[model samples]
Target: MTNLDFLLPKSSPTDLRSIVWPRPMTVLVTAPHPDDFDAIGVTLKYLKNQGHDIHALVAETGSGIDKVYGAGMTQEEKRQLRVREQTGSLRFFGLPDQNFRFLNLNNAPDDQVVDDEANRLFLEKLIRQIHPDLLFMPHGNDSNRAHRDMANMMKAIASKVEWPIALLFNSDVKTIGMKKDFYVGFDEADAQWKAQLLRYHDSQHQRNLRDRKYGFDDRVLMLNRKTATELGIREPYAASFEIDIL
Candidate 1:
C-alpha cells in the first residue's frame, strides 16, 4: 500500500472542542443587513445542529435598494420584499418568525454618518431579554461603514453589560483583515445548504449581479474556501471568527 499515513498530516491530540460553548447555550447573531447573516452561516448552522438556541437580529431593512435595483420600485416596496425574503431564508434554517427581529434602521449613504442612540438602546434591550451566552457580530475592521458602526455599537453595549458573555466577530465581504481565533468547518452538503439559504435574499441577488456578476452564494463559497485553505483544514468550507470575553 502507498504511504497514506505520511501523506496525511498528523492529527493533534489536543481536545479543542471546549473552545466552542457546550450544548444548550443561547446564541444571538447580529447582522448589519438582512443578507449579512450569510457571512456566518456555517457557524450558525453548526450551533443549531448542536441544539443551541439561536436568535437573529438584523440592524436595518437595507433601504439603499434603489441605488442597486434602480428607481423602478418604491422604498416601501423594496423594504417589504427584503423582509419577506429574509423571513423565508431564516425559515429554511428552521428559525421561527419570533426568533428573528429587524430594527428597520435607515441605511442610506448620507444617513450612514449618524449613529442612532435609540437603535442602540433597542439592541441593548433585546440583548438583556435574550441574555445570550454567545453573541455574533461583524468585525470592527470591516470596510463597510455600516458594518463598522454596528460593531462599535455592539462593543458599546457589551461594555455596559455586567454578566459574562462571549463575543465572536464574523468576517464580512468588506472585512479588510481579522485575527481569526476560531473556525467552523462544513462539508460540501452544508455549503450547498448555505448557498440555498443565501438565494432567499432575492433583492441581494439582484444587487450583487448589478455590482458583480456573481451573487452572495458565490462570494460566500469563495470566502469559505479561502478561509479553509488558509487554516489548513480538510473541510470544503469554513467560517472564521474572532472571540472575546465580556
Candidate 2:
C-alpha cells in the first residue's frame, strides 16, 4: 500500500477548482523545510480558494535534516524519503510539482543560515522572477536559525528591490513568538493536507519532541492548531503574517 494512503484519500473525480479558475492573485510563500507547507497548508488552501495564484518556494531541499535530525537514517535515505513524502503531500494541496520549487540553499553546518553575497544575489533574482503582489515567509520570531535566516533574506530582498508587496509570516513548532497581523481561514481538506505533509518528515517526528508513535505529531499538531487558533477567526487553519510597509 502507498505510505500516505491512510492519511490522504485519492482525488475526487471533480474538484471545486473549475469554479475558482482565473484566480486573481500573485502570491509567493517561502518555506525552510519540505513539510512547512503542511504547517501552513490550511492557509495555502484558503488563498487558493480565494482565487489567489499562489507560488510556493521552499528554500532548501533539506540535506542538513538527515545530518542533524535524521541521525538514524542515512543521508541518502532521509533525502529520498523526504522528497517522496513532500511530493505526495504537495499533490494533496492540488499544487503541481512545478509550484513546489525547491532551492538548493542549506543551513550552515554550524547552524547559521549565512546571508552572504551568493545568498543576496539569489534573493534578488528570485524576487525579480516572482514579482509577487504578496510575499510570505517565516517570521523572525522563529527560534530556528535557518528560518530566521530566510526571513532576513526576505527583508534583504525587499530592501534591494524596494519591494512594496505585503509580507506575511508563518511559524513552525521549533519556531515561536509570532503574532498574527492577518489570517486566512482554511477548511477540513486543508487540515488533512497538513497531516499528510507532516507525515512526510518521518525523521523529524521520530525525536522526543513530538509523539513516540506519531513521532513529531504532538509538536506539529500543537504548532498547527495553536497557530490556526491565534487567527481569531473560525477558519479550520490560518497562515499568519507581519507586514512591513517600507
Ten-residue region with minimum lDDT total, candidate 1 = 1-10
C-alpha lDDT (0 to 100) for residue 177 of candidate 1: 92
1-246: candidate 2 lDDT, tens digit per residue: 322122121331112222233326577887766676677666677678787787877654445353556667755465566666677767867887767676665457653346667977876787788787667777878777777877888777876665465566665666677555445555667656566666666656655344345545456666556656755556545445555543
In candidate 1, which residue pairs clash? none
Best by TM-score: 1
Query: All candidates' TM-scores?
Result: 0.86, 0.74
Superposed by TM-score, candidate 2 places the C-alpha of residue 81 at a distance from the truth, in angstroms, of 3.9
For 1-246, candidate 1 gives per-residue lDDT tens digits of: 221112121232111233433347788988777777766776787778788898998765545464756367665676677777888888888888899887766455543422568778878898999988778888989877778888888888887986767777886667899877767788899888898999888777777777889986887788889888888878877787776666
For candidate 1, give the lDDT of residue 236: 73
Which TM-score value belongs to model 2? 0.74
User: Who wins the lDDT comparison?
Assistant: 1
Backbone clashes in each candidate structure, one number apiece?
A: 0, 3
